[model samples]
Target: MIRGDDGIRAFFAGLARDWRGWRGVRKWDTIEHDLAIKARHTGRKIRLNFTLRPGSDRDYWIVTLEMVIPPDESLDRLARDIGELFGDL
Candidate 1:
């Protein structure tokens, strides 16, 4: 699991680099200390979120990957891919 503030920053930075290469556009929303983006990959609209949570002793983060399943795409496969993509963080 990711621990500490530096790890959190590094994680987001890496995500930015990867998504930027994929033509993702970042957006600022009402949420605090979070990152949101909208992008298209393989012609699919994707939403990515990195949310930060503060705890008693430390801060933590949650990563989410979302996309609409195309008629030709298997929901199970897409779900697994989304899980694996953000699960590491």
Candidate 2:
């Protein structure tokens, strides 16, 4: 299990506009996963790996949550929000 949730939250708390990458993140922040690239990016603006879905053409600006396992958990507020976003995805 990850340590203090605060750290994770803090890690991804103050992210500006996010970009949709190989993974479809729900948080719209950032989620890194090089191994699960092709298997996840399905051009749906959302993915099962917990990230913002990608589109055939970049029309919408998606803010990626970045990582399901936040690096910094100190920001509980952000963490909770990120988790909810994942739930929505």
Candidate 3:
């Protein structure tokens, strides 16, 4: 879904804006090609990491967003979120 630098920037911007109400949104950027966002889910308190990395091809980028769900979060809910984010992965 993410095409190039513009898409990456826009994605990070949206995450920053959307997660403002969470505890904190921390991000680290590489010189020209990578970005990492660390934040917790608002109500679930699940730790999430969103990373944007360059793709194998030129001018392409890939995004990986993962969550660390604790035992407190029900298996059903965790499964649902995972399914929504990464289908059949």
Compared with the true structure, model 2 gives a TM-score of 0.22
- Over 1-89, each residue of candidate 2 has an lDDT whose tens digit, in order, gives 23234333433333312223344333322333211211123343322233344444344544343333222333345546856654433
lDDT of 1: 0.41
What's the residue-level lDDT of 17 in candidate 2?
24
Better of 1 and 3 by TM-score: 3
TM value for model 3: 0.34
Number of colliding residue pairs in model 1: 0
What is the C-alpha local distance difference test score of each model? 0.41, 0.34, 0.50
In terms of lDDT, the poorest run of 10 residues in model 3 is 1-10
Order of models, best lDDT first? 3, 1, 2
Model 1: clashing residue pairs? none
Each model's TM-score, in the order given?
0.26, 0.22, 0.34
Candidate 2: C-alpha RMSD after superposition: 14.0
Misplaced by over 4 Å in model 2 are 5-16, 22-39, 50-80, 83-89
- Give one digit per residue, the lDDT tens place, for model 3 in 4-86: 34333443344434443444654544445465556565654446686777634535767778876543534345444534554
Each candidate: RMSD: 12.5, 14.0, 11.6
